[model samples]
Target chain A: MHDERMISFMFDTNLTKHLAELSKINFTDDEIAVISNEMSEIISLMDTVTEYNIDETFASADPVQFSDLRKDEIKDSFPREEILKNAKGKSDTCFKVPKVV
Target chain B: MNDLLKCTVKELSNKLNKKQISAVELTDAYLKRINEVDGKVNSYITVCNEQARISAEKAQKIIDAGSANALTGIPMSIKDNICTKDIRTTCASKMLEDFNPIYNATVINRLNDNNIVMLGKTNMDEFAMGGSSQTSFFGGVKNPYNTECVTGGSSGGSAASVAANLCAASLGSDTGGSVRQPAAFCGVTGLKPTYGAVSRYGLIAFASSLDQIGPVARSAEDCGIILSAIAGRDENDGTIKNIDKADYCSKIGMSMKGIRIGIPKEFFGDGIDSEVRQAVMNAAKEYEKMGCILEEVTMPSLKYAVASYYLISSAEAASNLSRFDGIKYGYRSENGNTYEEIIKNTRHEGFGAEVKRRIMLGNYALSSGYYDAYYNKAVKIRGKIKAEYDEIFKTCDCILTPTAPSVAYKIGALENDPVKMYSADICTVTVNIAGLPAISTPCGYSSNNMPIGMSIVGNSLREATIIAVADAFEKQFETKEASI
Candidate 1:
């Protein structure tokens, strides 16, 4: 099942660093080195999926049918205090965070 | 009363109903066992001693009123990820270390309606990200069989709690064999209901498409009892389909005659340990002895299972876990001057290494340039896997395979090697991908006495059939107790 064409994706420390940035995570140089090596190995292992030449016609992702879902009934929400209880910075009804600007 | 710890859920229910033991006494017995040995096992992140005793008192009242059911007054641990109304549902991560849900998960509500006593929140891999429980911030859960080894995770604590008699049974979440693998490692029974069988209204999602809440217990019947109580149509979760079988134990003790057990040759390949392979094969022979037919089947897509599973799961996880920003009801960092900085810093500080790695993988897979090569291809492979399982089930009643490639390894052995750790999930991930019901029960033990588990994978919503098959094997299986 191993195919030469499956080995096209390139993974390296640079890619790992970029992905971490996209993921909103900050890793140290040492951590990046370790994670890069691990990610390269994992991605290589995952490359097996590329071997299958599945017809895309059969794979138009099955959308969850609306009929399968239950009727969305209006219900009382959790109390404001309860909702805000676990937030680190919270006012009476809202979670407080740093200024976006 | 201490001997009562050895009883199954049904046996204990009988004792409680017969007035041989009060709910309080049974709860206390399990609580005492937990208090004594949990230091060594580290199975629990939080033990609800005071609340458990209080709930046990309430259960006694229900029993006195003659309104008790099978799980009434039964003490069981809940996985830390499942939301409980007032209990700290930590998810074994610093992110939600003290976050308490103001509402009970649908399953918790169902169990509560049955008057089941909650023991506490059991530990797990941080955000259920890793295969081994060592990634937990609260410290890893040690195997009850051998404390030096890992209890296969991310339901490791739940399985260990059941194996060590910390509780009569426990609830766990399975995403890529989390519940079954840990149960196998700890010598217990675990069931991963079809994706939509159990409601996921309040299960903290790891991979939304693959995640399922299940039971870990002493026997298949015990898991059945728990599943029956917890599973049903829930208006809160849109994914739950109306299942016909309300009682999973309804077909227990049925004859295995004429049952076609499928043995997929791909599952027992060079990757599987010889001992685990032999043990599962021995289990097939046991089924054959019970007059069941054994047929060698094929799942050609099995080789790509692990890869497909990781890609899809991580993609969903990236989306599901993005909600845990600093503004939310979880851990926050004080080091940031701006909103983005706060969110990024909080995540870096809160999540463990494995969780971060998965998030990175997920981001990489879903990123614009790689979406077609990774996530989309994974979804197609998933469809192919489900189709293959459908064809196999057309010819077989159930597919049997080793729950994991091998028995539990020593702690820290596979944690550093991401590929090795992910490869171990090859045998079990397809069931989740197909949304099938499967049970992992202790079949045989390794030469060094570690437990080996064999899984019976049934078609979608065939939970009762698989449970019955597991119960049949469990009745004759001489399972060893963990020497906690």
Candidate 2:
């Protein structure tokens, strides 16, 4: 069912590579083919949006507009212990990530 | 009574208030039902039996002290995506399988303040992503009405639990019809409140702009009761509207005389099952008999709504889900030595196929060259759709449509086809895109005995009118229960 050639032809190679890297999710060759085909179908569906003549002056819908800003008073914050409860790796009240250097 | 679990929230509340039934007893009945039936329905991912019993005992004390609210002592379920302090909120994904939040969602706090008993977390589509609960990591939730059929999704477990009498009511988030679709399929009542009505403080972010937590219950009036407790401004959630909460339950019994309902012709067009169309049209006629005015309205932008919704939601999802790296609080991969490798390996191992596909599509749309063509255009169309809905509301108080294109489909029916599954959301997604309030109530049952839901959509913040109309219709029709 996998069509590597078709997937390579459907999407721009560099764009696909960049997307794969950005998402940071590995896909097998077959999964890549399936994703590419599905993505092509979705993009074609999305192309219908271009056919509608949207007024240039119309702003996108903002469901709620923030007007009054709350006073920037120091409020109660989550306890550090609670905040770090779900951390995968922590050291001395700080999140420990893989060494960059 | 052994059948106490079958009572509506309102009925149970009355009984609790009258001291006829203790909250502990009510919770015990529901727990027993869950233990007996949930194996077949798979509505709950984690049953908090001991915790619920403890909460019930507290609720009983509150009732004895004569400080009970309408929801006090009621056993209700929360969707897995909504964070509950110290309770595992997985979003039905392996990524968050071991994650437990230190804080509760704003709605959970509200429920707690009202003395509602928590009946543990219900199952849902992972990250509230799929239309069918089939995408859940905990396994697909079966429709209470027919175990073989799907419970319409993302909130499938929420609706199924309510319909099957597993709980008095449940809370489910609707990004694009996650609540209402499942409610329709499961023969229950569900509401997707107007955007900004319910604060989204701790809901696992799927699409921030589209996500609104609402109630799922057996009746529209019950939904209103739950909404009144949870709907309000939250300083934590800046998107919440700064307005006083309306008395939603109070408006339920109001007269429907002269209320104008707009029926969009496009909603009834091709691909709608004949049974669903007939049922909704019959509901429209029922409204006419009740002295409500019905008019056919044109919404030319309906054709582009699904396309626009998918693009916008996926784009937002791509950005929102970027935080789930291996370093944070979720499933981490041991196979990778480098940071990038760890993140990639973790994501690959953690996310399911549908979720990964959406993420890829989202990243693809927002990619450097394709942003203007896809994301920008979709946003513009969304604006137009919202404007059109606003214009239509000037003449009509509410719009009526079928909640879903058809009744609950058989499991694995559309599982292989993503486009077909996407198309299943056609009737409901537009409401989310426009940020309106909509309710799904059981209008009738299909020939196969599956429920058909009719959606009543109101303009933003018009939940009172929507609930009033739904309650009236529910009273008049009295649709059959799921009979699990």
Candidate 3:
């Protein structure tokens, strides 16, 4: 839906400048406008929810646990031909390694 | 067959056991109904005639042996969001329009094990984001109750399929009222089982913590049957644990005496349609008549639920959806210079506008500088929302409210006004955010013959309690026909 509603976004370059320094990700003037527009929509959507008084017993959201199926067992390996067939680059039964250095 | 479509699961199961109808005959009847009405309604994304026929044949063999599974030969539609191995499981997004899942979701696997006939995959908001079902990459789903109005979002197709009698039941996912809201709008019964009560393995994640797969059908009893088959500890999802598995039908239709029902005051506030309010109060009156104690409970965090929920859910959405970068699977852009170009170009074209907007907003919220301010704070607020529910449950066994603020709106009414449409989910989102079990059942009709739904939420792991209260209400309107 229309981003909930528009909020007045302060054009503070402090956040822009800080993000630039922190992540080195670039944000153009157009990108800022889009972000501002989106944040405003979020503000509008957030307005419709109810936050009435609740008793002290309830927790907001609880993390329910399921038994972990992750195992430490060894997996069955693909045969030479099968593994080689899937490799984009390979050398004898092994996937080729790209040099990072 | 039209009369049969109106019966509850217990009624239908009893008749089937008595050999009053054959599985093949029932499947053919529903298939016929689907062919006749589905062209205009657009509920299904794919119709699995070949597979359903094969399964129906097998069910006939089992019946001859005098043995049958709980869901033996029953036709059911799946919301496109859940992955079904070998079936084209499109999440109603063009990105995966050609994608075929390699494995079935836990729920899909359960349905297969129970010998249920797989009718087809139904439509949804592209990747389950919008409230109107208008954002579905395939097309919009119409409310079976009123063709002019929308079947509420994400799970709209599943709800409509059952409402139109194309399927005896269907499975849907709820991140924020996707199942319950549509069930309300389409005049059916839907249950969003307690967090971890149902396995989510292979269900395409949309805010993994909030998303749940549940049943959308004609009766709460049907929802119970489907929920029982699909729930329990799975080797896949680790978030679900300590849940006591039981047959929900066994607990349903029981007297509500000693069942403490709480009516959340916030849900009855301004903007709720007078008719829907009257309908819910009427259901509450029925509860009181059944000797259930009704009390008004307060949940203050509900006020910020929409805000916190959007921030966190979208933040999760952006990360969960990043998997469709073209390189792995799905549509790949032919003309991109580098790997980056391929990823960006493919995504820019594959996803619809609504999906892109949510992704960008989510990515922005969780980005380096704003992570704590938005995503992190939202998580903390979530903790508080859970605390509130825990407190209320001690005083009441269940909480009741109108599923949506109003009945289905005209198809285009909220299409362009995205915020207005998102606000339509206000009553239902808090349950998802708080990770509680909730259900929506038809309460009454609006003046225009549109359907209204009443929701009953219970403590986590209390799906049976919700269904019992819902069944009690269903008894009052058991024979009411769709005004359409």
Order of the predicted models by DockQ, top scorer first: 1, 2, 3
Residue A81 alpha-carbon offset, candidate 1, angstroms: 1.9
Worst 10 residues of 3 chain B by lDDT: B475-484
| CAPRI rating of model 2 | acceptable
Clashing pairs in 1: none
Please, what is the whole-model Cα lDDT of each candidate in the order they appear? 0.89, 0.89, 0.79
Tens digits of per-residue lDDT, candidate 1, B1-484, equal 3788988999999999999999999988998888889999999999999999999999999999999999999999999999998889989999998898889999999999999999999999999987789999999999989999999999999999999988999999999999999999999999999888888999999998888999999999999999998887887877787765488988998889999999999999999999999999998999999999999999998998899999999998988889988686888988878888888888889899888888988998898877887889989888888888888999999999999999999998998888889989988899998888999999999988899999999998889999999999998999998877
Question: What TM-score does the first chain of candidate 3 have?
Answer: 0.38
Whole-model lDDT, candidate 3? Answer: 0.79
C-alpha root-mean-square deviation, candidate 3 = 4.8
Model 3: per-residue Cα lDDT over B152-213, one tens digit each: 98899998998888888999999999999999989999999877888888899989889999
Q: What DockQ does predicted model 1 obtain?
A: 0.57
Model 3 lDDT, residue B144, Cα: 76
State which candidate, 2 or 3, has the greater DockQ. 2
Q: Score the docking of each candidate (DockQ).
A: 0.57, 0.49, 0.22
Tens digits of per-residue lDDT for model 3 on A28-101? 56755664565466545543322223333443345544466667688765356642442334577664433424
